[model samples]
Target: MGFLDISHVTKSYGQVQVLHEVDIAVQEGEFLVLVGPSGCGKSTLLNMIAGLEAISSGDIAIKGRVINGVHPSKRNIAMVFQSYALYPNMTVGQNMTFGLEMHGVPKPARDAALADVAKLLQIDHLLDRKPGQLSGGQRQRVAMGRALVRNPDVFLFDEPLSNLDAKLRVDMRTEIKKLHQKLKTTIVYVTHDQIEAMTLSTRIAVMNKGYVQQLGTPKEIYDTPANLFVATFMGSPAMNILPATVVMEGGQPHAEITDADGARRLLRFSQGNLAEWADKPILLGIRPEAITDPEGADRKSANIQPLANRVTVTEPAGSDTFVTMTLSGKDVIARMRADAMVAPGEVFDFAINMDKAVAFDPATEARIPQ
Candidate 1:
């Protein structure tokens, strides 16, 4: 058993079932992020873990001990909520120590813990101030400090950074990462932001419509999505999925797709197993970074197919330019270096890294194993 285990867990209200057979085993000190869109049951799963919501069935255990019937206060877990649930009338230090006081902890011990955590979170100066006197970021730090003083076995973050502005969110994200590294605590963070999942997680569970679509390391989920939904949901520009047919050429499989000018083009497949799929209709998947200007193509790829296609749109996004063109009657984006001189309505030689390509069964929408 792992440090935290959710086995065969299901949740339902009345007759409408929400979560089905959800299972996850989080190792000690592992940063696991439950990421998905709003109402995907990520928060519900988290609440179940925190004992804020009871499991309809199955078990939730911590350190091999069942906690399904335990109270939220007795669960040995700390939660940093999105709203920064702090008392407006209480000073930061008082708010931080109130939980310990409620548990009958001695004043001296609570004070010591408060001092240490406040210093660690760099909020020692704000300890005497009320929640209303602090800025948003300071209030967040105080909320985190309150949880830190408890030194719980598990940390539950429910979209904790969602309330902060963009720049502060990034700053606090780094702070949280540093805190985790120093403390090495097990954390289950829930966020609707895919970028947070990619940047912060040791493993990610991507949920959709109350089901976990896929669970794996961020790299694995991004590079080899389990299905079409994961592919389209987990990235910034999203993976470009084009309708194509697998055709055999020179005893190898090639994706037969139409270019901008309505001319058919062939790109060789690096996965030799695709040869078995010859003459079959399949959806070709390629990330925008895999399609770039010739000079920006990945040097490690052996199969860099070259194609001259007319660009329909060019978006300059500071560090890189997003070039869009029609392929297989779909808008395909190519990520190119900012200095690449190609413009819209011009025929440009683009390099496609077929080595990074993936394929999906058109009917089932599941990824065809590489």
Candidate 2:
């Protein structure tokens, strides 16, 4: 059995079904992230795992032991909240040891636990300071230290970095990843930010409308999204999905794309067994980074094909330029080097790496297996 198992879990509120039957399995020391937009039930699922929310049906198990109705504290899980959830009046040290002290652990033992975690989290200097006196990141560390002092079986983070500024959020993300490496414990984190999930998770469960849409490693989820929802939801600027038709040209399957102006271009996919899909409509998805300059094309994989779609707009980010062009009636973005200063209305030689390009069944919005 997996270290943590969520089996056929469901949730509802008086005729309103929120979370559908959901299942996820997380291995020991695995960092699993539940990510989706607001109201998608990612937080609700985390709460269910923590025993804060009652499961309407199905079971949750920790190491094969069913914890259906277990109390939150008895579950031996520590939760760090987005708000930090620190005690206003208590100092960092006091906040860190309160749970231990409440359980009647002797003062000496509690102090020892606090000291070790404080030093480990590098918050020893701020132990005596109150949460109010600490910066957002510091307060977050104290909250984490509070959870760490218990040394629970699993760490649950409910969007812990949501309150921090962008740079601090990135820093805290690194710290959390390092902490996981150092402790090698199981963790289940919930967040609406796909970037956080991609950066922090050993595996990610992408949810939508109360259902787990896709669950896989970051690379798996990004490169081979299960459906249109996952393909459009998990990346920054999302994946560019365009309408296309599969056709056979010279015994090989190719996707024919027609822009708004009726200009046509063909993109060949590396996968086989696509001959039967000829003349059928499909959703063609390509990431911005995959459509890059010819020199930047990945040489290792031979899925690189050439095309020149007329650029309609260009957004110059510091490290890369986002070039926008109409592809098969859809606006698609391509990531190019910042120095490639192609003017709008110009047709630039864009190399497309389709080794990872995906096709979806337009009727079901499900990816077509290669």
Candidate 3:
């Protein structure tokens, strides 16, 4: 058994069901991130774990004890909300200790606990100020400090950094990682940002339409997605998926795509045993990084095929450049170094690292077993 287990959990609001039979087992000190787009029911599942929302069926167990019907406060799980849910009327110090005071803790004990958390979060000076008097980043620290004072079994962060600006979010992400490292506590964080999920979690659960699409380490999810939805959702630009037909060339498996000019291109994948799949239509998934300029090809890849393709769009994003081209009548994105001289309406030999390619069955939208 894991430290926290959600066994076949489901949730509904009267007749409207929102969460399916979702099961997540979180180990002690594991940082699990539940990430998806808006209204994806990630928050609903989190609420169930926190006892803020009722589950229609199934069990939620913490440390081997069922907590499905436990009170939120009694769950011993502290939550940090997106809005930095601090009391505007109270000073940061008061906000940090309010929960303990309400629970009948003595002032001395609460103050001691608050002092420790304040020091840990480096917000001692801001403790006398109210939430309104602090910056967005500082208020977030206070909210986290409030939760830390409780010293709960699990930390539930419901998009805690969502309110901060991009730069602050990045900084806070690093801080949260460091805090987790020092505390070694289990964390279940929810976010809509794939980048946050990638950077923060030990494992990420990508959800969609109330169901968990895939759950794996960030690298596992990014390198080998379970399905098409996951392949397209977890990455920054997402994996480029194109329809192609499997063909055999010189007794080897190859993915064939016909260009707009009737020219057929062959992409040899690293995985073998494609004899049966030949002549069958399949979806090819490739990340932008896997397709680059000749000089930009990943040195570790065993196979890098160069295609003379015309660039339809060229977008320079700081350190990297993204170029769009057509393959099999589908737009494909390739990542290149910022210095790569790529321009629209120009035909260039693009290096594609097929060794990192993934194949999916179009009908089921599931990755083909390699």
Candidate 4:
């Protein structure tokens, strides 16, 4: 019921099932990124959409038409591979237009399409050169240009920026985002890099162990993870999770955790529904940024609680300082302003923004719903 729909899609290799009951509805002109660790079946699901891998069961449709049995060429989909996959011997212009030529298109139309896409991708100067003569970024642009000239119904990218250097990867990421905005094309991109997924996708499908742990906008995924796997996987520094107990204090639910000296400390939660979990053990999830120096705490947060703890280590990371301490027998990190004056073995008053805190069912590893 979407522009690109994967309804009850599953893929199996003989007796072993890799992808299970996966469903995603990608809207028109939307950018969807499949992100997870290596061997998590992100690429396998992408291959299924590209018609390179057969679906064991279920259906994949584009614009309401099922393409389950369609050939790769006839599916009206263009793909850009991680390796660029350009012809080494063919000129850039030939490589870009060869697919059109094979479809029996006239030479004039092929030339016109090539010129427009090459200009759009800023590769007009490299059309006469071969793939061997260009830089890594230029070759990537050529690969993208090849796909753009086809005017396919969908564009599938299989870790296309993974081959570039770190700086070039960032540069290409911006370029791809700009291209998507300009053309308003539907794109399904696959990457294991969470940062790439966060920055590029309009929506992200965070997969793990052959399952989509969470599918949501970046803000939703970061702010409210569906489960423990999503909370730990999608962020750069990762969310801090520790064991805690829900205790009622003054008719309000509070998280009771142990500080560095094994002293019981209480931090009130913003979710009033947690009152039902009174006297029950739960896993508390908090992002590093939510725990900060008293002066650096979020001013808008209504539930800022003071938590004094001994800092075990202080890491100055240019823009922000990451302070580490032990709480609930687990290492907890706090992000503070780089200029904050706290050192190792010093007791600092850290602010806990309970407004941004989340609680999880420790046994099921699922987030506690508000």
The candidate scoring highest on lDDT is 4
The TM-score measured for candidate 3 stands at 0.98
Clash pairs (backbone) in predicted model 4: none
Full-model lDDT, candidate 1 = 0.93
- Across residues 30-104, which tens digit of lDDT does each residue of candidate 3 receive? 999999999889999999999999889999999999998899999999999989889999999999999999889
What TM-score number comes out for model 2?
0.98
lDDT, candidate 1, 1-370, per-residue tens: 8999999999999898889888899999999999998989999999999999989999999999999999999999999998989988899999999999999999999999998998898899998998999999999999899898999999999999999999999999999888889999999999999999999999999999888899999999999999998898898898999999999999989999965567899999998899888999999999999999888999999999998888999999999999998887799999999999889999999999999899999999999998
Clashes found in each candidate (C-alpha, N, C closer than 3 A): 0, 0, 0, 0
Candidate 2, residue 177: Cα displacement in angstroms equals 0.5
Ranking by lDDT: 4, 1, 3, 2
List candidate 4 stretches off by more than 4 Å.
259-261
Candidate 4 structure, TM-score to reference? 0.98
Q: Work out candidate 4's RMSD over C-alphas.
A: 1.0
Question: Residue 135: error of model 1 in Å?
Answer: 1.0
Which sections of candidate 1 miss by over 4 Å?
259-262
Clashes of 1: 0
What stretches of model 2 exceed 4 Å from their correct place?
Answer: none
lDDT (Cα) of model 3: 0.92
TM-score for each of the candidates = 0.98, 0.98, 0.98, 0.98
